[model samples]
Target chain A: MFVWIILIPILIQYTLTSVVPMLISFFLTFTDWNLVGTWNNVGLDNWKRLFSDRAVWDSLKVSVIYALYSVIPTVVIGLLLALAVNTRKKGTAFFKSAWFFPVITSVVVVASIWKWMFTAEADGIINQVLGLFGIEPQFFFGTRLALITVALLGIYQSVGTAMVYYYAGLKGIDTNLHEAAKVDGCTGAQVFFHITLPLLRPTMAYVLITLTSGALKVFDSVYTLYNQTGGPQNAANTLVMHVYRTGFFNMQMGYASTIAYLLFAIIMIISVIQYRITNRDVE
Target chain B: MKKRILNFFFYVICILLCVIFLFPFVVMLFGSLDGETKYAVTLTSWFPTQFSLKQYQSVLSVGGRMSRWVLNSVIISVIPTITGVFLDALLGYIFAKKRFPGRQLIFWYFMAAIMVPYQATIVSNYLLYSWLGWINTYWAFLIPGMWTVLYMFMMRQNIAAIPDALLEAARIDGAGEWRTFLQIVLPVSKPGLSTVAIFSFMNNWNNFMGPLIFTTSEKMYNLVVGLSSLNQQSASFNMQMTAGVITFIPMFLVYMAFQKYFVDGITVGSVKG
Candidate 1:
């Protein structure tokens, strides 16, 4: 009875904030409503259109690439960085906090900073650097480079959290394992690959799933960096942005819901599979 | 000797990496003063070409609306964060210490809800907020995001670490539940509370999406939304970076001061999330 008293407020809030909204979003997927119209049944038309829609298909492709590009490098580099800083030595704290700064920063702040750096002009910081190597200025926001540049920003922001998680995972590995491996005359590299790598599997799975999900739903960077529009010719457009533009900007709530549901399905399927694999029963 | 050499190599790389990580911030800091200093970056150096507070002054001016945005960000972030800390800790206490009928079921429901991504809420939330006339109001942000499932999980885990005997003893002393929670549970759980508070503040202060969708007026816009959209009004990178620095300062100071909680939070958070 007492527990219910404590849970009541949050429960009511969650129901209104999350549960009801999600069900409404799901229902909106089937309707023919735009913002101004009364939503009636659209039958399977939206689903059929979603299947054949070229822009949605393209955004999906972009999202996948963005996820892979950001997640893979962040994991690999972050793990390596974590290992490097896993020491209990002086100044480790400073280094840890330094890298972790970006993780706490608002995406808009970081995007704003990076936008100035990657400006398409010849005088832009990055282009100026490239100029020293005898290369012409590159238009980072152009079709050729917009998505990749965005991915780099995403990767930069994520690496810190991944490193922190990996560091914790590394610290949790029993020192005795290293001692035993050393007694067996293993090299440092050998011990890491043989012992530390296997122990960090759970951390890797968590980081990968989060990084992938974050990448899939990425909107702030794209929205901010390119100024509400995706990028030149929609090259940097993502599924989330598509949904936002369709629903809010274009006021096509039903169509936006359809895209959102598709995204939700993709994310759910991936997460379910990940959960099944990662949560194998010890029983 | 070989071990010494390897250690040297590691530290060198780590230092270089830290420098690379901080380079962008350095640019922002110096670039912020660029307006009055009449300086921009050169390959020769990334330092302030000249020093001036003109950019910061302009950013702080009423016309910039940067100060108002900062105040708005504070209200939006701080109120929710403070409220969330209490609510999150309370939920954590109940879920962790109390075992009543349907407790596990309720806990699992929240756990499942955590898996639903933010994108799932955007369309309906927008429509819902619009219909509620919550667009352009802080209520949209507070209502949905006032308390987070992530913080609840963190608090639950933290409080659960305290042995039941602590609570049992408090009860045996004839202490009321509120008294026990306030004097005993809260003191012991300061670290958890701080962790939740820091994360809550960070997320709220930097939150762009909720404000972007919910509020259209300049007065209600938080720093992230207002700061990012500054290019629409002015193309000056110096002034913009100055505004960015203004936004970054509070979070940075809080982080430095409360570094312990952050380290503790990550270690425990890894196991659950």
Candidate 2:
């Protein structure tokens, strides 16, 4: 009785907030209604429109590219950083904290700082570095480089989180395996590839799935960096950004829900694929 | 000799990566200190040649909006953190320890909620909140986010580790569920509670989208949204850096203070669970 009394309210709140909204979102996909207007049953119209939507496809392409750019580097570099810091040598704590600092920092601040650094002017820090190599000033956010630049910012912020996860994964590995491999005349690289890499599969699955989903839903950095316009020519507009623009800015609720559901489906499919590939040996 | 050489190279590489990671923060800090004259010049140095708090002074001055945003951030973050910790702890305790009808059904229902991406539900959430007259109000952030399934899951895992004997003993002493929760469970689960609190606080403090969408008035903006708006307004780099630094300081301090909890939370969240 007491348990029910306590749990009932939270469950009610949860249903109202999460479950109801989700059901409503599903229902919205079958109907068309701007916030202030009457609902019209559109049935499969939004879904059909999704197929021919050039902007939707463009944003999907941008999101996939962003995810590829961000997720791969985040995983690889994060693992390297984890390996370095996992040496457990003296002074490694400082390095761990230093590397993990950005994970705690807000995305808006990170975008702001990186946007400043990637300023297109010759005097911008990155452009200045380029100039030292006798390269011309590059327009980072102004050109096709915009998506990559935003993706790099995503990588910068998330690499710390990935590093922490990989570090934990590294810590979980049995040191005896490494020593045994070493005694068998296995090289460091060989031990890592043959033993450590395989053992870290579960962690890889977790990291890959989470990072991929996060990357696909990438919005905060791009929104901030591009000033909510999704960059010049919508170059950096991610799927979530497209949803936000459609639903909020354009006031097309039904179409926005359709795009959002499609994104959800994509994430679910990709996460399952990643889980299967990474966990092939585990089961 | 080969091992020593390899170790030396590893250190070199690690040091270089650390510099790469830390450079932007250094830039943000030093950039915030530059006076108007020095900021207008071509970037010749990473460090400010002339150091001044002119930007910070302007950003945080009485006439500025940064302070309001800071307050909004605090209200938005602190309320959710406190409420989330308490409610999640209670609910986690219920799910973990209590024997009740429909427990598995309710728990799985909450678990299933996690599969639905927040983006998918956001459109309806917007419509629902607006219908409830919550737009431009703190209620939008506070209500929907007061308790999360993820935090509840964490708390459930944490609270489950409490030996059943201990809880049984508490009940044997004639303590009610609420008393047992307030007295025994919470004290034993301090580490878990703190971990949840820190994460909750961090997520709320740094949340950009909720505040951005919910709050139309400039005064209602949290620091993250406020800073983004300032950037969108094409504020000077120095000014924007100052805002960035201001926004970052609280989380930095929190991380510094609870550094252990942060690492433990990450490992516990990923590696173990």
Candidate 3:
């Protein structure tokens, strides 16, 4: 009875939050409903519109660019940071925490700071610094450069997670493997490439997949920098922002849900591709 | 001599990196002191030419019900995290020790869900919340995040590391599953639980989109949303910085105080699986 009493609230909480929302999403995908009005079955219309919508395609393309931009470099930087810290002269703990500082800081804080940094005016610090080199002040958020800049910030913020995972993986490897390689006259770089890299595959796989998904769904950074307009002229528009605009700004919850589903499908297809590629060697 | 030189260079590099890491704190501190500092260039200003605590004063005073926002965030985040610890532990224990039919399959199901990006479910989730009339309530912010599947999986891995003989002896002594879990598992899994708790709390604290989608009213907003609204309402450099500092403080305090446990918490889950 006591356990049941405790479980009821949790169960109710989960049902209300997770279970119900998932089921409703599935239902809403096949319907034409806005938030304020009645939802009716419009089977395949939303799905069809999803296929033909140029904005959807463009937004998803932006999402892919954003995801790849963040995911790849994040993994590389994370690996380098882990490898750097793993050398362990001293103060590894301090360095580890510092690297993770941005992770805990709200995206709002980071985006706010970066927004100021990328401000287009000559007063913008980035431009001011570049002026010393005689380069004209560039509009970072107004061009494709804006999207890439946002992706770079995403990398900075999220690299800590990849670093932590990689560090953990590094620690788990038997020290003897390095010793054995050293005995065989292998250099440090050689050992890292041949031995450490292969051993860390599982961790790499985990980090890569998670980072990919996170990059795909990234909205807050771009939203904040662009003030939720997807940057100037929708140049930085991503799928999530598209859904957000469709639902909230355009008052087309049905269309937004459709965009959301398209995003879901793309993510799913990419995940499947990643699994196949990452797991092929395992079997 | 060569090795010593290499070590010196390494420390130099590490110290420089540390300064880069600490730059934001420097920016926040100095920016907080200046009443008129706005724009990125102001950060480059060495000292506050005109110092005033009015930013801090007003932030503490009529800061759009921020204190209430913090209180609400705490209630929503802390309650769910506490309850989630128990739920995840219970589920983890079952996965680690118990012999139920389809246990592995069920465990795998949860593990697979970890890979499914939250985007896959966001629309569905919103619709469900709309149907349940949960939109704009604290429950909306708290519910989806509570009882994370990854934490449960991580806890199960940590529990699995404990020797099976310990649990077998408890079982032989005729203790019930729940009792053995309380006595044997909970005590040993303290470090693991703390790690999960800190990670979950941080996730909930910094989450912007969850509240953005969920909370319709300003009164119900968490600090993240409140600060964003503050930015929109006023471009006043001092006020924005003050709000930024207010938002950054709790997390900075937590990170500084519990740095070790937090790092361990993050690395443990990652390393184990």
Candidate 4:
């Protein structure tokens, strides 16, 4: 039957793409193997090195920082923009479209514009804007500012996603709840806090989970901006970029898989913790 | 009076954010046009003193390879969009309507794959592809994403919503499963197909790391990766901006054409179900 066709393609694709690689990744994490050459079984060596490696720790620190700095604002701004644009007022469509423009556009393009903006030159937008306020040109891609600057660019691309989710959450809320709150003499702020916020918990959890994982997996922003050099002094070097570099560029495939598994572990832990936090109240 | 003021405040804040949201795009377009000199000092003006198509010309230049890059992007994105949509829908239909041995297990496998970072698979996939002699080929892009977990999940949800009665009616009318699926289910799942198409297209079109890692040569570069490489080599700032605009245009057009599906798909498929 044609059911075989459907099942066969999917199974074959998944096996090649995910299953084989994942099993290989697990094996690779134990043995040190460069792509072309034979490898030695360095049992627990990659795992042990992960504990002691300063670069791994530094990249983890950067990943955590990037994850936090990017996710919090994205969720907050998304909620705010959703609340703001989720209205029946004139030109609300325009506002919604404008906010969502970044989401639909390629992240590479956004990063390109931002890279141009963050140029250390006097003509760069950030420098120009700063100059307007009587400040000198700032080398935004430098160590001190590079990570946060990239996160800001990400927030621009991300806020739209948050807004969409929050907007959907807002739409799904019963209008009667709002009217009931109003009738109960609740102020707008009070109503939002008491009802809308609580009701949007599921959406919030989903947004934060996706956003946090996204922040952890960030490659494009830093990749585009720094020309894949991991930004100044490796400040913006993220977990995924670390994995890419170690595996591909440095050809340390085994160690890279170790890092990859560590990242997966981190993601799993964060998801589990957030899952519990967001779900506990329902219990 | 207070309500009026509050509403006005909302307008102010919302509009301000929208402008902020759109500002980079404005710069990517207007700024691209404004100062496209060999050593373009773009800060000189917000608008071009002399309106020139020079930057756009260079991006589309024979030497620049922008046109080739664009062609690569279109071929890569469009093929996958057409092929992947069908693949996802077919597999998704099975997942949705049929119950079989290890069906639950297979679906769970896909779900788990979606959670693992793409970076995790790079080492092994690269080795596998290289072993398959697919490196520096479009098959590197075309084959890997023949079916993605996300698209499959979305398609499953979409196909699941089609009424059982509809399928039974078609079946009772002597329609084969394939005929029923093609005749009835496909028609009903336009929204799902479109959503998958846009996402797959966009993901392919905007993809950077894939082209970066897989294709080792300049000639095989997609729009994003080519522009990114050219970004450093670009003679001037305006050239980069112009290239950005060109890269942005296709996705923008696709989005505008299917704005309803794109937006609704987001709210429906992406948001927590």
- Residue pairs whose backbone atoms clash in candidate 2: none
Q: Tell me which residue pairs clash in candidate 1.
A: none
Estimate TM-scores for all models.
0.93, 0.95, 0.89, 0.94
- TM-score of chain A, every prediction, order shown: 0.93, 0.93, 0.89, 0.91
lDDT of 2 by residue, B64-173 (tens): 78988989999999999999999889889888988878999999998876667777668898888888899888899888888878889899999999999998998999
Off by over 4 Å in 3: A1-15, A269-283, B1-12, B37-40, B62-64, B100-112, B163-178, B261-273
Top TM-score model: 2
State the lDDT of candidate 1 residue by residue for A1-283, as single tens digits: 6667768877888888888888888888788788886888988788889999999999888888889888999999989878877876778878888889888777877888787677777887888889999999999989999999999999889899899889877887899999999999999889989998988888888788767877898999999888898788998889998889888888888888889987888888877866664556221
Error of 2 at B244 (Å): 0.6
Q: Candidate 2: what lDDT?
A: 0.86
Q: Top lDDT: which candidate number? A: 2
lDDT of each: 0.83, 0.86, 0.77, 0.82
- For each candidate, the DockQ is 0.56, 0.62, 0.47, 0.58
Candidates, ranked, TM-score: 2, 4, 1, 3
Write candidate 3's Cα lDDT for B1-273 as tens digits: 988998888778777877766676566666777867564443256357788887777667754487777777787778878967887888787777767566676666566555455655666666677767888887676666668888897788889888999998998999877888899999999988887788778888887887887787888888888878776675655566666788788888888877767657765433243
lDDT of 4 by residue, B1-273 (tens): 999998898888877877778878887787677643644434556566777776776668776688888888998898988988888898889999987888898888778875677776778778778888988898888887776777888889889999999999998999998898889988899988988888888888888888888888889899888778866675466777788899999989988888777766675434343
Per-residue alpha-carbon lDDT of candidate 1 for residues B143-162, written as tens digits (9 for 90 to 100): 88778888888888788898
Residue-level lDDT of model 3, residues A147-233, one tens digit each, is: 888897898798888988898889889999899999999988899999999999988887887788778888888777777788777
Restricted to chain B, the TM-score per model reads: 0.90, 0.94, 0.87, 0.91
At residue A77, candidate 3 shows an lDDT of 85
Residue-level lDDT tens digits of model 2 in A133-206? 99999999886699989888888888888888988888878899999999999998999899999988788878
Task: Give the worst 10-residue stretch by lDDT in candidate 3 chain B.
Answer: B38-47
